[model samples]
Target chain A: MLSDMQNNEFQTYGYTFKEVGLTPGEIARFLKVDPSEKEHPANVFIHEILNKLPDNKEITGGYRILPVDDLNVKEGRLACNNVELNPGRQVSTCLQKSEYIALFVCTAGDIFTGLTRRFNRRGDSLEAYITDAIGSLTVEKAMDGIQSQLEKAMKKRDLQITDRYSPGYCNWPVSEQKELFALLGETPVPVSLTGTCLMIPIKSISGVIGIGKEVRKSKYACAVCGDENCIYIKIIKK
Target chain B: MEDLLNKLHNCVEFGKTDINSPYPPDRKGQKGALEYTQELLEKGASPTNIMELALIPAMNKVGRKFSENKVFVPQMLLSAKAMNVSVHLLKPYFRTGELKRKGVFIIGTVFGDLHDIGKNLVAMMVEGAGWEVVDLGVDVKPEKFTEALRQHPGAVVGLSALLTTTMVNMKPVVDAIKAESPATKIIVGGAPLSSGYAFSIGADGYGKNPQENVLWLNAIGYAK
Candidate 1:
């Protein structure tokens, strides 16, 4: 039994490059160019790509807090109301003390994917690459919005929320995305899973956040994750 | 003619695709690789010379900058795009055997890995470097690679896998290709791959990025 959650009821965010907190310096870093140079050609290229994005485009994400019926921290599993989840170590470790959990889905939407494909077909792969990066940043910003909303809701209940944990992260296999999507009830962001379990819109993300008074967020979760290629970790190091 | 060729090289190096392209603001409204290549050809510059002098040198500079970490995929892709436009104008010469391609290179992402950004980058870079690239698209199987090898004999192969889980799948592809053609060089790359892991999986080389792969191909005499 799944309950439909209205997309309008949850906090959703739309972003431009500036609103997403993406700086030229960060874009330069991602491009592996010298950020010290205030007027690099890459910076100009970044601006050009930004200007080409649709003004009406929005990357929306929202979450619903669901009651957890049971949780087993040692076994790294949880039964959240109607959905039984084996969230794995990384998620369960952060979720053990939670009374409830929030299931969230965020998407940069199909517009960006369509734009990327168009650029690719036109042989403007540079624009395609930049658009793809922008999509990533948009989804990340949407996730940030979802986290803040979850935090606010938890605060009203005298509880705190743990860091966001997606199924593909750490020991939680990507195959579990089906269960996560199922738990979220109706699609909040129009993201679908492929036959192989990969997310469509390519830039969409889904995750779970534990809500409890004792759930503490890690200061630097990227450090513990061991994925050296993570953009967040790279940004922190720089 | 030399001045026009030099301008064409600069256009490609800086990723100026055309007069309408707004990138590299300093060159705004200036004729880019497309116009410059056409103008150079009109001035009676040899197609082979345009490739060897203008396109090849520009791509080499881009590849070096990429290896030095001075440019990322966006920058590299721009440069590759510029080079591609110039190459397109010279395609007639290639078809006539007047402008020879270095060799055939087949590339694809391994099965279960739907990611194509990295694969596309590599394919474009290699194509810009004067190779004839046969892109097999994404989620390719080992048999497909072997079949491609059968079709394009003596061609080099590239496999990409963005996920750690799918990276392990490269071993089977590598083994299958090697079994079919022992002389064929196989390279692997993606976010989760390292040169050490590439070697462990029987891959001949591992490129940290597309530029590195171009460099490796050059080093192995894949380019003339």
Candidate 2:
């Protein structure tokens, strides 16, 4: 229903939703919306997923890598687990190093539905609601997307994807967004970054697939990278 | 007097919500869009005159500033806030059927993606341009969009994704919408989205930002 502009915020943005449910207060604060407003149903599920997020695990051998389009020998060696991690070992005894590794990452991709209805109601701050919902959904989607891609890419290579890693995770500095971008030639991939390196569209994903002989580079690396607090993590050593 | 509109526009453009609100340290304590809008309204100003001469122009400026990288999210949020304050004052007349929206829009972040900021911005900007936006929230399934389309008939649909991985999910949703409602226009956006990608995914349009989405909607002559 459209109307002449009055002091109506709803009219400014037709339908709107505010962050509602569990962390609605926190999200509302982040989105700069009034938290006391009626809660949106989407926020309920968002909280549910957030609460249930499995601890982030560096799932070794969880995925395989496949060249989505082309695979050239010039790109380096493509060896299965044949390559030995010991640099001093005989080269002939090891699998040839593939110049670059392209693997699909995957994780359990289950969240809830009806988020919009829960957030955007008949009478509410449409803009504020949408903003809050965007923030919540983006992170959830991005993480899942990256995980899923790793899983899929690795399955193709027949070699397991050591737990996916990005530059900023663990010892990896946030500054690696650039190197990672360069490695993937991300500009052509439709993904971009803000001035502060925050990924937009919030639900987008990114990750790294190591091209090494050791199944996981090293078990220690995997342990350090495991997000023990993640809702989906299968194991939590802590 | 000509510069007064620019000043008012800038106040809103930079996100000065009201005369009393303190933000953007540079414009602290000054009359904001809220005051200027009310003042304009009381001065026998036509609604169209206020919109065309002040509000629209201000948003346009903000949009341009945003495109040029002179401003970022915080500044844009402020501008949106200022614009909202003025719009809040204009709501009653519309509810009374004194005004009309150009059309309806249904938007959301695709399944597996829970982000909504970019979608929200588009919703706001489109609404400012006189569209009734039905925000489906995050992780929206295609059926919900189809359901909304069934209800609205010709409403435009916007899909947002912030992750490269979640963008894949958009294809199935778009396919579903196209299968059920061939004529419903769809728009896609987010960090990992581009015009090329939007076309590949079968969306009718792509918006890089809220302001751009407004311009796109207006350019298609969809607004009445």
- Write down the DockQ of candidate 1: 0.31
Q: What is the lDDT of candidate 1?
A: 0.80
lDDT tens digits by residue: candidate 2, B38-148? 887676665655566676677777777767767644456567667777777777656876655567888888887766657766776776666778988887888988898
Give candidate 1's TM-score: 0.79
Instruction: Provide the overall lDDT of each model, using Cα atoms, as 2-decimal numbers.
Output: 0.80, 0.55
RMSD of every prediction: 4.9, 16.6
Total residue pair clashes for candidate 1: 0
Q: Which candidate is the best by TM-score?
A: 1
Best by DockQ: 1
User: lDDT by residue for model 1 over A4-26, one digit each (tens)?
Assistant: 32232444455544456666566
Q: Summarize candidate 1's per-residue lDDT along B110-157 as a digit string, tens digits.
A: 988778898998898888788899999889999999999999998899
Clashing pairs in 1: none
